[model samples]
Target chain A: MSLEERFNEIVREYSERVYWHVRRFVNCHEDADDLVQEVFLKIWRALPSFREESGLYTWVYRIATNEALNYLRREKLRSALHFGSVDEEMLRRIDNDPYFNGDAAERALSKAVVRLPEKQRQVFILRYYDEMPYEEMAKVLDTSVGALKASYHIAQEKVRAFLSKVD
Target chain B: MVRKNDISTPQGYFDELKGRLGDIPHRDRRGVRIFAPWMAIAASMLLAVLIGNFILRKTAAPVEEDNGWDYISYLAQSLDPDGLPDEEFLTDVEQ
Candidate 1:
Protein backbone atom coordinates (compact mmCIF):
# COMPACT_ATOMS: atom_id res chain seq x y z
CA MET A 1 0.00 0.00 0.00
CA SER A 2 1.07 3.62 -0.52
CA LEU A 3 2.48 5.20 2.63
CA GLU A 4 -0.45 7.54 2.92
CA GLU A 5 -2.95 4.73 2.51
CA ARG A 6 -1.13 2.68 5.10
CA PHE A 7 -0.97 5.58 7.53
CA ASN A 8 -4.67 6.29 7.04
CA GLU A 9 -5.44 2.69 7.83
CA ILE A 10 -3.37 2.92 10.99
CA VAL A 11 -5.08 6.13 12.01
CA ARG A 12 -8.53 4.69 11.48
CA GLU A 13 -7.66 1.59 13.46
CA TYR A 14 -5.70 3.03 16.39
CA SER A 15 -6.64 6.67 16.87
CA GLU A 16 -9.47 6.09 19.31
CA ARG A 17 -7.58 3.45 21.19
CA VAL A 18 -4.53 5.64 21.52
CA TYR A 19 -6.67 8.56 22.56
CA TRP A 20 -8.28 6.63 25.37
CA HIS A 21 -4.93 5.33 26.54
CA VAL A 22 -3.60 8.85 26.71
CA ARG A 23 -6.77 10.17 28.29
CA ARG A 24 -6.40 7.73 31.17
CA PHE A 25 -2.90 8.95 31.85
CA VAL A 26 -3.72 12.65 31.58
CA ASN A 27 -7.26 12.62 32.91
CA CYS A 28 -8.12 15.42 30.52
CA HIS A 29 -9.55 15.35 27.04
CA GLU A 30 -7.62 18.30 25.58
CA ASP A 31 -4.28 17.00 26.75
CA ALA A 32 -5.14 13.54 25.47
CA ASP A 33 -6.10 15.01 22.12
CA ASP A 34 -2.74 16.75 21.74
CA LEU A 35 -0.78 13.71 22.95
CA VAL A 36 -2.65 11.40 20.59
CA GLN A 37 -1.66 13.56 17.63
CA GLU A 38 1.95 13.53 18.77
CA VAL A 39 1.86 9.73 19.10
CA PHE A 40 0.62 9.37 15.51
CA LEU A 41 3.19 11.85 14.29
CA LYS A 42 5.94 9.77 15.84
CA ILE A 43 4.40 6.65 14.32
CA TRP A 44 4.33 8.28 10.91
CA ARG A 45 7.98 9.30 11.16
CA ALA A 46 9.09 5.88 12.33
CA LEU A 47 6.91 3.82 9.99
CA PRO A 48 9.57 3.58 7.30
CA SER A 49 11.90 1.79 9.71
CA PHE A 50 9.25 -0.56 11.10
CA ARG A 51 10.28 -4.20 10.47
CA GLU A 52 7.10 -5.74 11.87
CA GLU A 53 9.11 -8.27 13.92
CA SER A 54 6.68 -7.53 16.71
CA GLY A 55 3.11 -7.44 15.56
CA LEU A 56 1.85 -4.01 14.51
CA TYR A 57 -0.62 -3.88 17.41
CA THR A 58 2.10 -4.45 20.00
CA TRP A 59 4.40 -1.91 18.35
CA VAL A 60 1.65 0.67 18.19
CA TYR A 61 0.67 0.11 21.81
CA ARG A 62 4.30 0.43 22.84
CA ILE A 63 4.56 3.79 21.14
CA ALA A 64 1.29 5.02 22.63
CA THR A 65 2.21 3.82 26.11
CA ASN A 66 5.68 5.40 26.00
CA GLU A 67 4.29 8.72 24.86
CA ALA A 68 1.75 8.69 27.67
CA LEU A 69 4.46 7.94 30.21
CA ASN A 70 6.64 10.74 28.90
CA TYR A 71 3.74 13.16 29.09
CA LEU A 72 3.02 12.17 32.67
CA ARG A 73 6.65 12.65 33.59
CA ARG A 74 6.65 16.11 32.11
CA GLU A 75 3.43 16.94 33.87
CA LYS A 76 4.87 15.77 37.17
CA LEU A 77 7.94 17.92 36.72
CA ARG A 78 5.84 20.92 35.83
CA SER A 79 3.66 20.55 38.89
CA ALA A 80 6.69 20.05 41.10
CA LEU A 81 8.22 23.25 39.77
CA HIS A 82 5.06 25.05 40.80
CA PHE A 83 5.03 23.39 44.26
CA GLY A 84 1.84 21.46 43.51
CA SER A 85 1.04 17.77 43.59
CA VAL A 86 0.69 15.97 40.25
CA ASP A 87 -1.89 13.58 41.68
CA GLU A 88 -3.97 16.47 43.03
CA GLU A 89 -3.74 18.18 39.69
CA MET A 90 -4.90 15.03 37.92
CA LEU A 91 -7.76 14.55 40.37
CA ARG A 92 -8.88 18.11 39.72
CA ARG A 93 -8.69 17.53 35.98
CA ILE A 94 -10.79 14.41 36.35
CA ASP A 95 -13.39 16.27 38.36
CA ASN A 96 -13.58 19.17 35.93
CA ASP A 97 -13.31 17.31 32.64
CA PRO A 98 -16.38 17.91 30.49
CA TYR A 99 -15.84 14.69 28.58
CA PHE A 100 -15.86 12.57 31.76
CA ASN A 101 -19.45 11.53 32.34
CA GLY A 102 -18.72 8.66 34.67
CA ASP A 103 -20.94 8.01 37.67
CA ALA A 104 -19.59 8.98 41.10
CA ALA A 105 -18.14 5.53 41.73
CA GLU A 106 -16.39 5.44 38.37
CA ARG A 107 -15.02 8.90 39.01
CA ALA A 108 -13.76 7.73 42.39
CA LEU A 109 -12.13 4.77 40.73
CA SER A 110 -10.37 7.06 38.29
CA LYS A 111 -9.13 9.18 41.16
CA ALA A 112 -7.90 6.09 42.93
CA VAL A 113 -6.09 4.85 39.85
CA VAL A 114 -4.36 8.16 39.32
CA ARG A 115 -3.10 8.19 42.89
CA LEU A 116 -1.15 4.94 42.44
CA PRO A 117 2.60 5.05 41.90
CA GLU A 118 3.45 5.63 38.26
CA LYS A 119 4.54 2.08 37.41
CA GLN A 120 1.67 0.56 39.30
CA ARG A 121 -0.77 2.93 37.60
CA GLN A 122 0.47 1.85 34.18
CA VAL A 123 0.12 -1.82 35.07
CA PHE A 124 -3.31 -1.27 36.53
CA ILE A 125 -4.61 0.60 33.52
CA LEU A 126 -3.33 -1.93 31.00
CA ARG A 127 -4.58 -4.93 32.94
CA TYR A 128 -7.89 -3.56 34.21
CA TYR A 129 -8.92 -0.98 31.67
CA ASP A 130 -7.53 -2.49 28.49
CA GLU A 131 -7.96 -6.05 29.79
CA MET A 132 -4.60 -6.70 28.20
CA PRO A 133 -3.02 -10.10 28.82
CA TYR A 134 0.12 -10.14 30.91
CA GLU A 135 2.22 -11.36 28.00
CA GLU A 136 1.07 -8.55 25.73
CA MET A 137 1.50 -6.03 28.55
CA ALA A 138 5.05 -7.29 28.94
CA LYS A 139 5.70 -6.64 25.26
CA VAL A 140 4.12 -3.18 25.39
CA LEU A 141 5.80 -2.19 28.65
CA ASP A 142 9.16 -3.90 28.12
CA THR A 143 8.66 -5.43 31.56
CA SER A 144 8.74 -9.10 32.46
CA VAL A 145 5.32 -10.64 32.93
CA GLY A 146 6.13 -11.48 36.55
CA ALA A 147 7.00 -7.84 37.28
CA LEU A 148 3.83 -6.67 35.55
CA LYS A 149 1.73 -9.01 37.61
CA ALA A 150 3.35 -7.78 40.81
CA SER A 151 2.77 -4.13 39.86
CA TYR A 152 -0.84 -4.82 38.91
CA HIS A 153 -1.43 -6.60 42.21
CA ILE A 154 -0.12 -3.66 44.20
CA ALA A 155 -2.10 -1.21 42.05
CA GLN A 156 -5.30 -3.16 42.48
CA GLU A 157 -4.95 -3.16 46.26
CA LYS A 158 -4.33 0.56 46.31
CA VAL A 159 -7.37 1.24 44.13
CA ARG A 160 -9.51 -1.01 46.28
CA ALA A 161 -8.38 0.63 49.50
CA PHE A 162 -9.00 4.13 48.09
CA LEU A 163 -12.47 3.17 46.87
CA SER A 164 -13.39 1.70 50.25
CA LYS A 165 -12.35 4.87 52.06
CA VAL A 166 -14.34 7.07 49.69
CA ASP A 167 -17.39 4.82 49.96
CA MET B 1 -17.82 -1.51 38.56
CA VAL B 2 -15.96 1.34 36.94
CA ARG B 3 -16.21 1.21 33.16
CA LYS B 4 -12.92 1.45 31.35
CA ASN B 5 -14.15 4.58 29.62
CA ASP B 6 -17.02 6.85 30.36
CA ILE B 7 -15.55 9.71 28.37
CA SER B 8 -16.77 10.32 24.82
CA THR B 9 -15.68 12.70 22.10
CA PRO B 10 -17.97 14.65 19.87
CA GLN B 11 -19.50 12.76 16.95
CA GLY B 12 -17.28 12.18 13.92
CA TYR B 13 -14.17 12.89 15.98
CA PHE B 14 -12.32 9.72 15.03
CA ASP B 15 -13.15 10.21 11.37
CA GLU B 16 -11.81 13.75 11.56
CA LEU B 17 -8.73 12.56 13.40
CA LYS B 18 -8.10 9.98 10.69
CA GLY B 19 -8.33 12.63 7.99
CA ARG B 20 -5.98 14.89 9.91
CA LEU B 21 -3.40 12.15 10.46
CA GLY B 22 -3.60 10.91 6.87
CA ASP B 23 -2.52 14.35 5.68
CA ILE B 24 0.75 14.18 7.65
CA PRO B 25 2.76 12.32 5.00
CA HIS B 26 1.73 14.80 2.30
CA ARG B 27 2.42 17.71 4.61
CA ASP B 28 5.85 16.35 5.44
CA ARG B 29 6.60 15.75 1.75
CA ARG B 30 5.61 19.31 0.96
CA GLY B 31 8.12 20.54 3.54
CA VAL B 32 10.77 18.30 2.01
CA ARG B 33 10.13 19.82 -1.42
CA ILE B 34 11.23 23.21 -0.14
CA PHE B 35 14.75 21.79 0.20
CA ALA B 36 14.82 20.12 -3.24
CA PRO B 37 18.10 20.02 -5.16
CA TRP B 38 17.21 22.99 -7.34
CA MET B 39 16.42 25.12 -4.32
CA ALA B 40 19.58 23.99 -2.57
CA ILE B 41 21.67 24.87 -5.61
CA ALA B 42 20.00 28.24 -5.97
CA ALA B 43 20.57 28.98 -2.29
CA SER B 44 24.23 27.96 -2.53
CA MET B 45 24.76 30.23 -5.56
CA LEU B 46 23.10 33.13 -3.80
CA LEU B 47 25.29 32.63 -0.73
CA ALA B 48 28.46 32.48 -2.86
CA VAL B 49 27.53 35.71 -4.62
CA LEU B 50 26.89 37.43 -1.29
CA ILE B 51 30.21 36.23 0.18
CA GLY B 52 32.09 37.24 -2.99
CA ASN B 53 30.57 40.75 -2.92
CA PHE B 54 31.46 41.14 0.75
CA ILE B 55 35.07 40.09 0.24
CA LEU B 56 35.41 42.33 -2.81
CA ARG B 57 34.12 45.28 -0.81
CA LYS B 58 36.45 44.59 2.14
CA THR B 59 39.64 44.12 0.11
CA ALA B 60 38.94 46.71 -2.61
CA ALA B 61 41.31 49.68 -3.08
CA PRO B 62 39.70 52.83 -1.82
CA VAL B 63 38.87 55.36 -4.52
CA GLU B 64 41.17 58.37 -4.25
CA GLU B 65 40.16 61.90 -5.25
CA ASP B 66 41.40 62.53 -8.81
CA ASN B 67 42.74 66.05 -8.13
CA GLY B 68 45.46 66.64 -10.78
CA TRP B 69 48.31 67.44 -8.35
CA ASP B 70 49.20 63.72 -7.75
CA TYR B 71 49.51 63.07 -11.52
CA ILE B 72 51.66 66.19 -11.95
CA SER B 73 53.80 65.12 -8.98
CA TYR B 74 54.14 61.60 -10.38
CA LEU B 75 55.29 62.95 -13.74
CA ALA B 76 57.76 65.28 -12.10
CA GLN B 77 59.21 62.59 -9.81
CA SER B 78 59.71 60.10 -12.71
CA LEU B 79 61.28 62.72 -15.00
CA ASP B 80 63.43 64.46 -12.35
CA PRO B 81 63.62 64.10 -8.56
CA ASP B 82 64.49 67.87 -8.48
CA GLY B 83 61.72 70.27 -9.50
CA LEU B 84 63.84 71.54 -12.50
CA PRO B 85 64.63 69.38 -15.54
CA ASP B 86 68.08 69.41 -17.25
CA GLU B 87 68.50 72.00 -20.03
CA GLU B 88 69.19 69.20 -22.56
CA PHE B 89 66.05 67.28 -21.62
CA LEU B 90 64.03 70.50 -21.82
CA THR B 91 65.43 71.17 -25.32
CA ASP B 92 64.40 67.59 -26.38
CA VAL B 93 60.87 68.21 -25.16
CA GLU B 94 60.78 71.48 -27.15
CA GLN B 95 62.02 69.64 -30.29
Candidate 2:
Protein backbone atom coordinates (compact mmCIF):
# COMPACT_ATOMS: atom_id res chain seq x y z
CA MET A 1 0.00 0.00 0.00
CA SER A 2 1.02 3.61 -0.47
CA LEU A 3 2.43 5.66 2.38
CA GLU A 4 -0.72 7.72 2.60
CA GLU A 5 -2.86 4.63 2.99
CA ARG A 6 -0.47 3.29 5.59
CA PHE A 7 -0.58 6.59 7.43
CA ASN A 8 -4.34 6.65 7.31
CA GLU A 9 -4.47 3.13 8.69
CA ILE A 10 -2.04 4.00 11.44
CA VAL A 11 -4.03 7.08 12.32
CA ARG A 12 -7.27 5.15 12.44
CA GLU A 13 -5.74 2.41 14.52
CA TYR A 14 -3.78 4.45 17.08
CA SER A 15 -5.08 7.99 17.30
CA GLU A 16 -7.47 7.28 20.15
CA ARG A 17 -4.88 5.32 22.08
CA VAL A 18 -2.38 8.14 21.58
CA TYR A 19 -4.96 10.69 22.66
CA TRP A 20 -5.74 8.90 25.94
CA HIS A 21 -2.07 8.32 26.67
CA VAL A 22 -1.44 12.03 26.16
CA ARG A 23 -4.45 12.95 28.24
CA ARG A 24 -3.03 11.09 31.23
CA PHE A 25 0.05 13.29 31.06
CA VAL A 26 -1.76 16.58 30.68
CA ASN A 27 -5.14 15.83 32.36
CA CYS A 28 -6.80 18.26 30.00
CA HIS A 29 -8.62 17.74 26.71
CA GLU A 30 -7.46 20.65 24.56
CA ASP A 31 -3.79 20.13 25.36
CA ALA A 32 -4.08 16.40 24.81
CA ASP A 33 -5.95 17.02 21.55
CA ASP A 34 -3.19 19.33 20.39
CA LEU A 35 -0.55 16.81 21.43
CA VAL A 36 -2.29 13.93 19.67
CA GLN A 37 -2.01 15.87 16.43
CA GLU A 38 1.60 16.72 17.17
CA VAL A 39 2.41 13.06 17.79
CA PHE A 40 0.94 12.00 14.44
CA LEU A 41 2.81 14.81 12.71
CA LYS A 42 6.03 13.44 14.21
CA ILE A 43 5.04 9.95 13.19
CA TRP A 44 4.33 11.06 9.63
CA ARG A 45 7.60 12.96 9.42
CA ALA A 46 9.64 10.12 10.88
CA LEU A 47 7.82 7.26 9.17
CA PRO A 48 10.37 6.88 6.37
CA SER A 49 13.23 6.77 8.84
CA PHE A 50 11.46 4.15 10.95
CA ARG A 51 13.73 1.11 10.73
CA GLU A 52 11.28 -1.19 12.51
CA GLU A 53 13.92 -1.69 15.20
CA SER A 54 11.10 -1.54 17.74
CA GLY A 55 7.44 -2.45 17.41
CA LEU A 56 5.42 0.34 15.81
CA TYR A 57 3.33 0.75 18.97
CA THR A 58 6.39 1.20 21.15
CA TRP A 59 7.98 3.51 18.61
CA VAL A 60 4.87 5.68 18.60
CA TYR A 61 4.82 5.54 22.38
CA ARG A 62 8.41 6.73 22.57
CA ILE A 63 7.64 9.71 20.38
CA ALA A 64 4.46 10.51 22.31
CA THR A 65 6.21 10.13 25.67
CA ASN A 66 9.02 12.46 24.71
CA GLU A 67 6.59 15.03 23.37
CA ALA A 68 4.52 14.91 26.55
CA LEU A 69 7.55 15.25 28.79
CA ASN A 70 8.91 18.14 26.75
CA TYR A 71 5.49 19.81 26.86
CA LEU A 72 5.22 19.39 30.63
CA ARG A 73 8.68 20.83 31.12
CA ARG A 74 7.77 23.85 29.02
CA GLU A 75 4.51 24.28 30.93
CA LYS A 76 6.35 24.11 34.23
CA LEU A 77 8.75 26.81 33.10
CA ARG A 78 5.87 28.90 31.80
CA SER A 79 3.92 28.47 35.02
CA ALA A 80 6.92 29.37 37.13
CA LEU A 81 7.57 32.47 35.11
CA HIS A 82 3.91 33.45 35.19
CA PHE A 83 2.74 32.44 38.64
CA GLY A 84 5.85 31.99 40.82
CA SER A 85 4.83 28.35 41.25
CA VAL A 86 4.80 25.19 39.14
CA ASP A 87 2.98 22.84 41.49
CA GLU A 88 0.30 25.33 42.39
CA GLU A 89 -0.20 26.36 38.80
CA MET A 90 -0.50 22.78 37.55
CA LEU A 91 -2.88 21.95 40.36
CA ARG A 92 -4.99 24.93 39.44
CA ARG A 93 -5.00 23.98 35.80
CA ILE A 94 -5.99 20.42 36.62
CA ASP A 95 -8.74 21.47 38.97
CA ASN A 96 -10.20 24.21 36.89
CA ASP A 97 -9.91 22.27 33.63
CA PRO A 98 -13.27 22.21 31.85
CA TYR A 99 -12.73 18.77 30.44
CA PHE A 100 -11.91 17.20 33.78
CA ASN A 101 -15.01 15.86 35.50
CA GLY A 102 -13.35 13.55 37.96
CA ASP A 103 -14.81 13.04 41.38
CA ALA A 104 -12.86 13.67 44.56
CA ALA A 105 -10.78 10.48 44.44
CA GLU A 106 -9.82 10.82 40.80
CA ARG A 107 -9.02 14.46 41.33
CA ALA A 108 -6.85 13.49 44.25
CA LEU A 109 -5.08 10.91 42.14
CA SER A 110 -4.37 13.44 39.42
CA LYS A 111 -3.05 15.97 41.92
CA ALA A 112 -0.81 13.37 43.54
CA VAL A 113 0.54 12.21 40.23
CA VAL A 114 1.19 15.78 39.20
CA ARG A 115 3.27 16.28 42.34
CA LEU A 116 5.74 13.57 41.39
CA PRO A 117 8.88 14.47 39.46
CA GLU A 118 8.75 13.99 35.74
CA LYS A 119 10.09 10.43 35.43
CA GLN A 120 8.23 9.18 38.44
CA ARG A 121 5.03 10.74 37.22
CA GLN A 122 5.47 9.11 33.84
CA VAL A 123 6.25 5.70 35.27
CA PHE A 124 3.34 5.90 37.65
CA ILE A 125 0.86 6.90 34.99
CA LEU A 126 2.02 4.18 32.63
CA ARG A 127 2.01 1.55 35.33
CA TYR A 128 -1.00 2.51 37.39
CA TYR A 129 -3.26 4.20 34.91
CA ASP A 130 -2.41 2.57 31.60
CA GLU A 131 -1.30 -0.74 33.17
CA MET A 132 1.43 -0.96 30.57
CA PRO A 133 3.85 -3.81 31.12
CA TYR A 134 7.31 -3.01 32.43
CA GLU A 135 8.95 -4.25 29.24
CA GLU A 136 6.77 -1.98 27.12
CA MET A 137 7.28 0.85 29.58
CA ALA A 138 11.04 0.33 29.35
CA LYS A 139 10.84 0.55 25.58
CA VAL A 140 8.89 3.80 25.75
CA LEU A 141 10.97 5.36 28.53
CA ASP A 142 14.28 3.98 27.19
CA THR A 143 15.15 2.51 30.56
CA SER A 144 15.90 -1.00 31.77
CA VAL A 145 12.93 -2.93 33.06
CA GLY A 146 14.53 -3.18 36.52
CA ALA A 147 14.93 0.60 36.61
CA LEU A 148 11.35 1.18 35.44
CA LYS A 149 10.00 -1.15 38.11
CA ALA A 150 12.04 0.63 40.73
CA SER A 151 10.85 4.01 39.49
CA TYR A 152 7.27 2.81 39.47
CA HIS A 153 7.61 1.56 43.02
CA ILE A 154 8.92 4.90 44.15
CA ALA A 155 6.19 6.74 42.26
CA GLN A 156 3.47 4.52 43.71
CA GLU A 157 4.67 5.21 47.24
CA LYS A 158 4.84 8.94 46.68
CA VAL A 159 1.44 9.09 45.05
CA ARG A 160 -0.12 7.00 47.80
CA ALA A 161 1.47 9.22 50.41
CA PHE A 162 0.14 12.32 48.72
CA LEU A 163 -3.32 10.79 48.39
CA SER A 164 -3.34 9.94 52.10
CA LYS A 165 -2.49 13.52 53.05
CA VAL A 166 -5.03 15.07 50.67
CA ASP A 167 -7.78 12.62 51.43
CA MET B 1 -12.58 3.51 41.65
CA VAL B 2 -10.36 6.17 40.13
CA ARG B 3 -11.24 5.49 36.51
CA LYS B 4 -8.56 6.59 34.13
CA ASN B 5 -9.65 8.41 30.98
CA ASP B 6 -12.18 10.24 33.08
CA ILE B 7 -11.45 13.33 31.09
CA SER B 8 -14.00 14.30 28.46
CA THR B 9 -13.42 15.98 25.12
CA PRO B 10 -15.82 17.67 22.79
CA GLN B 11 -18.13 15.12 21.27
CA GLY B 12 -16.76 13.42 18.16
CA TYR B 13 -13.31 14.77 18.79
CA PHE B 14 -11.66 11.42 18.10
CA ASP B 15 -13.91 10.61 15.16
CA GLU B 16 -13.05 13.87 13.43
CA LEU B 17 -9.42 14.37 14.40
CA LYS B 18 -8.01 11.99 11.81
CA GLY B 19 -9.78 13.60 8.88
CA ARG B 20 -8.86 17.02 10.19
CA LEU B 21 -5.19 16.09 10.54
CA GLY B 22 -5.03 14.44 7.14
CA ASP B 23 -6.70 17.53 5.71
CA ILE B 24 -3.86 19.74 6.91
CA PRO B 25 -1.36 19.94 4.07
CA HIS B 26 1.66 17.68 4.42
CA ARG B 27 4.53 16.87 2.12
CA ASP B 28 6.73 13.83 1.99
CA ARG B 29 9.75 15.33 3.73
CA ARG B 30 11.84 12.28 2.92
CA GLY B 31 11.20 12.80 -0.77
CA VAL B 32 11.88 16.51 -0.42
CA ARG B 33 15.15 15.95 1.43
CA ILE B 34 16.25 13.36 -1.07
CA PHE B 35 15.65 15.55 -4.13
CA ALA B 36 16.15 19.09 -2.76
CA PRO B 37 19.93 19.28 -3.24
CA TRP B 38 19.77 18.05 -6.84
CA MET B 39 17.12 20.66 -7.56
CA ALA B 40 19.33 23.33 -5.99
CA ILE B 41 22.33 22.24 -8.09
CA ALA B 42 20.30 22.21 -11.32
CA ALA B 43 18.80 25.57 -10.45
CA SER B 44 22.20 27.06 -9.68
CA MET B 45 23.64 25.74 -12.94
CA LEU B 46 20.77 27.22 -14.89
CA LEU B 47 21.19 30.50 -13.00
CA ALA B 48 24.94 30.53 -13.71
CA VAL B 49 24.29 30.05 -17.43
CA LEU B 50 21.75 32.85 -17.41
CA ILE B 51 24.08 35.22 -15.51
CA GLY B 52 27.07 34.19 -17.64
CA ASN B 53 25.06 35.03 -20.75
CA PHE B 54 24.12 38.38 -19.27
CA ILE B 55 27.73 39.21 -18.35
CA LEU B 56 28.98 38.02 -21.74
CA ARG B 57 26.43 40.21 -23.52
CA LYS B 58 27.34 43.18 -21.27
CA THR B 59 31.04 42.66 -22.20
CA ALA B 60 30.67 41.23 -25.73
CA ALA B 61 33.42 40.84 -28.35
CA PRO B 62 34.59 44.38 -29.14
CA VAL B 63 36.22 43.69 -32.54
CA GLU B 64 34.28 43.99 -35.78
CA GLU B 65 34.61 41.26 -38.47
CA ASP B 66 36.35 43.65 -40.86
CA ASN B 67 37.90 46.61 -38.94
CA GLY B 68 38.54 44.58 -35.77
CA TRP B 69 37.93 47.72 -33.63
CA ASP B 70 34.19 48.16 -33.69
CA TYR B 71 33.69 49.00 -29.96
CA ILE B 72 36.93 51.04 -29.66
CA SER B 73 35.95 52.97 -32.81
CA TYR B 74 32.49 53.46 -31.42
CA LEU B 75 33.92 54.75 -28.16
CA ALA B 76 36.43 56.80 -30.13
CA GLN B 77 33.57 58.29 -32.06
CA SER B 78 31.46 58.65 -28.87
CA LEU B 79 34.17 60.55 -26.99
CA ASP B 80 36.90 63.09 -27.80
CA PRO B 81 39.96 61.35 -29.27
CA ASP B 82 42.17 62.93 -26.53
CA GLY B 83 39.74 61.56 -23.91
CA LEU B 84 39.49 58.09 -25.54
CA PRO B 85 40.29 55.11 -23.30
CA ASP B 86 44.01 54.29 -22.81
CA GLU B 87 45.76 51.92 -25.30
CA GLU B 88 45.94 49.09 -22.71
CA PHE B 89 42.18 49.41 -22.18
CA LEU B 90 41.73 49.26 -25.95
CA THR B 91 44.01 46.20 -26.16
CA ASP B 92 42.06 44.44 -23.45
CA VAL B 93 38.88 45.38 -25.26
CA GLU B 94 39.95 43.22 -28.29
CA GLN B 95 37.87 40.14 -28.70
The numbered model that scores best in lDDT is: 1
Candidate 1, residue B87: CA error in Å? 30
| Candidate closest to the true structure, highest TM-score | 1
The residue ranges of model 1 lying beyond 4 angstroms of the native Cα positions read B1-5, B31-95
Interface RMSD of each: 3.3, 3.6
Question: Please, what are the lDDT tens digits per residue for candidate 1 over residues A1-167?
Answer: 97667888899888888888878899887888889988998999989888878888888988998999999899889999999988899999889988887799999999998999888988888888777889999999888999998988888889899999998
| Predicted complexes: DockQ each | 0.31, 0.24
Q: Residue B35 of candidate 2: its Cα lDDT?
A: 93
lDDT score, residue A137, model 1?
90
Instruction: State each model's CA lDDT, in order.
Output: 0.85, 0.81
- Residue-level lDDT of model 2, residues A42-80, one tens digit each, is 888788788777889799888888899888888878977
TM-score of 2: 0.72
Candidate 2, B43-63: lDDT as tens digits = 999999999999998898776
